[model samples]
Target: MRNVLITGGAGFIGSNLALKLVESGSNVTVLDNLSPQIHGDNPELSPLYRSILGKVKFIKGTVESRQDWNDALVGIDTVVHLAAETGTGQSMYQIKKYSDVNIGGSAILLDLMANEPHNISKMVIASSRSIYGEGKYLCKQHGIVYPNARSAEDMKLADFNVKCPVCSVSVELLATDEESKIHPSSIYGVTKQVQEQMFMITGQSLGIPTVSLRFQNVYGAGQSLSNPYTGILSIFSTRIKNGNDINIFEDGLESRDFIYIDDVVESIMLSIFKDEANYQIFNVGSGVCTDVLTVAETLKNVYQSNSSVSISGNYRVGDIRHNFADLTLIRSKVGFEPKIDFLNGIKKFTTWVNKQEIQKDLYEASIQEMKSKGLYK
Candidate 1:
């Protein structure tokens, strides 16, 4: 069994990936600070404090610290770096915080991996499509405003460009390929780009195989519903479940390529084991774009419940009008294909949300909870 270290393994994507590695009979070690912001005050995460945790070896620590990296790297053969301060809008205000973890922490990890005794062979990083920024290519094709209707001819070109009309962006913007230019609009995206570069350079210099997987909007079970800074699907589902109004920041026309957690995990696994994916970057997405309004409506339909939705003119700063992923690289490399369609993924997510016992909160409340738990401290 290969010894694998997963940083930020308590968070949604990291945790899901950890679970997958364990089930595949790998010796998985999860290194996490369990920042109350991500894990919450739930006692279940603590070994001495709870009985409901998974079987992987868990270490409570920060990736930003050198000592934590030293402790976690012992006997590790692979590292899947997924930790980041992932708030696009909030990063505008807290640029330093985003850089500290995403860039600084990653730099430290790469440095350690290079000097370590076990000689780490492979590393995979969790990247974001935000690095592409507000796709100018999309703006040129669809105009500043979205088209009222599109035809097969439009779709063919869109298929070539990878644009989305309802969102007023191209699949070229949505389905960003490996060659897509990096133009980060937010501090978060900027840091992710830096993080990717660090791994690429370090891996090449150190003779270690590194891969970066640019993930689309990922949503599934175990995501924190309390934070508006993360997990839109969870936030929407929880709000509708509680008889609260779901807020759409824009006209609900902006589209995103949302990928399920399972598919994302599979992509990571493929990246790790497959020699063909080394020193490469791949976009992990469903290759389809859906608007926010459609997602809200689908949630309402799946739950068989009625909930109000309000579309506000205010939108988050640096928020992409439309973004999706070009799946040509990953599909060709690992034979990766998203099996769960949008409606099916929504149904699964809604069902999971319906079964949860915990109460969900909005943006301000989420921040307040994080502060109260001493996460920021």
Candidate 2:
């Protein structure tokens, strides 16, 4: 567990994790393609990467390349697989690209683990909350249930709440536990599910310790504001900075669990040394649900922006109604608890965003790209 390799180690979560590992005396190797979506094609390294410069080995490559993986895996005994296409919306139209990078890339890594001789004894794969589409809910009539993804027709009518399948009554969102059913409404979630299943199945055969962390909406200071594909906070911040109104989808009551970067890194660090985390899937999140409207308003207040915030009552396919993690498993298993609350974390993030040079808000343009491909209506 000393010599560690982090795939996609140059991005938001990856970069933060690498810094912690390096600080703790672990030999860290980062394998990243630095996709132009996150970093410009001919761009300087992100400020996060620059902060960790000269401290660890950096490989500019993709996870699918065998040679690059081999080079990155040299003397590495632990692998943290974080590289993947992240946009849930963009994933709808860019099906092949998402599958190739997420599922196919993880397959290559597992194949290397099986066929290649290496010192890999431990592996951690990043899973997503999206797998439990709409998440676990409770009907007043029905005790506990897993609601289905809201239909476009229903969303068209502005019915943004999850309803019981049997009674058709609006259900309440309970904290989704790891035991929740796997019903991903998006292609990205499906790929992540495949990636996690592969790691667990293969790790068992190879007698390697494996951990799958279902990360909630992860955000923090180092997050790339340039990437409009993910990070609602970053996207909103970018738009507000550019004097653009924040577009709220599906009435803005839809909520998600947002965990700070430091908390996420702590969970991974725990998994590395914790035998209890071996061959287990833990939900890593802030354990609190914050609605889209709240998120937009908070960002606006923090920035003191005159940007108008409005909800369209419009929705996207494969989007969930409400979901937050049940931290019971992770806490009981590894004594993991989120330290940063939502307000404090957002303030820290806003402070970081204010320091960085303002960039073009690509929110609408990215949505337009999705619309052109018929992914967004």
The RMSD of every model to the true structure, in order and in angstroms, is 7.0, 1.1
lDDT of 1 by residue, 278-339 (tens): 99999998888898888888887777767877776434546666777889889998888988
- After superposing candidate 2 on the true structure, give the runs of residues whose Cα lies further than 4 Å from its correct spot: none
Top model by lDDT, which number? 2
Give me the displacement of residue 267 in model 2, in angstroms: 0.3
User: Top model by TM-score, which number?
Assistant: 2
lDDT of 2 by residue, 1-377 (tens): 39999998888889889999988889999998878788754445567667657888999899878889889999998999999999999889889999999998998989998997889989999999998888898898889988877767777688877889888899888999999999999998899888889999999999999999999999999888888889999999999999999889878888999999999999999999899999999999999999999999999998999999998876777788888999999999999999999999999999999999898778888888877876665
Q: What is the lDDT for 307 in model 2? A: 96
**Model 1, which residues run further than 4 Å from truth?**
43-54, 136-174, 364-377
Model 2, residue pairs in steric clash: none
What are the models' TM-scores?
Answer: 0.85, 0.98
